[model samples]
Target: MTCDRLVCANCAAPVNEGRCPVCRASRERLQQQEGVLGALTPAALLVLLVALVAVAVLARSFAG
Candidate 1:
């Protein structure tokens, strides 16, 4: 849920534009909340999928 597309109810404008104080504050809060997980791009997801497959293979081999 990024704030880039959020519409501010205070001024009936886009939050990213910061049309009002409430919109700016809400945008800032959303940005801070997404700071951590927001950086997980497609490449990171691909790497994580590969790691999961490798782990699954190892687990199956050990079980057998």
Candidate 2:
């Protein structure tokens, strides 16, 4: 989950704001753990998957 959407239990505030030590730690941890595709939204990821499948099909058709 993104820090902007996360609520900090320690400070009862948004984690992105880093209102307390817990928020800062959690935010840092989340930032470090995000992977290459982590930033992509679900819709964006779905579009990318569809494009990749289309490319593979085109490549196979051209090769055949």
Which predicted model would earn the best TM-score?
2
For residues 1-64, write the lDDT of model 2, one tens digit per residue: 6888889888899999998999999999998888888788999999999999999999999999
TM-scores across all candidates?
Answer: 0.62, 0.89
Which residue runs of candidate 2 sit more than 4 Å off their true CA positions? none
In angstroms, the error of model 1 at 43 is 7.0
1-64: candidate 1 lDDT, tens digit per residue? 6776889988999999898999989988887887776867878979999999999999999999
Clashes of each: 0, 0
Give Cα distance to truth, residue 58, candidate 2, Å.
0.5
lDDT of each: 0.88, 0.91
Q: Report the Cα lDDT for residue 10, model 2.
A: 83
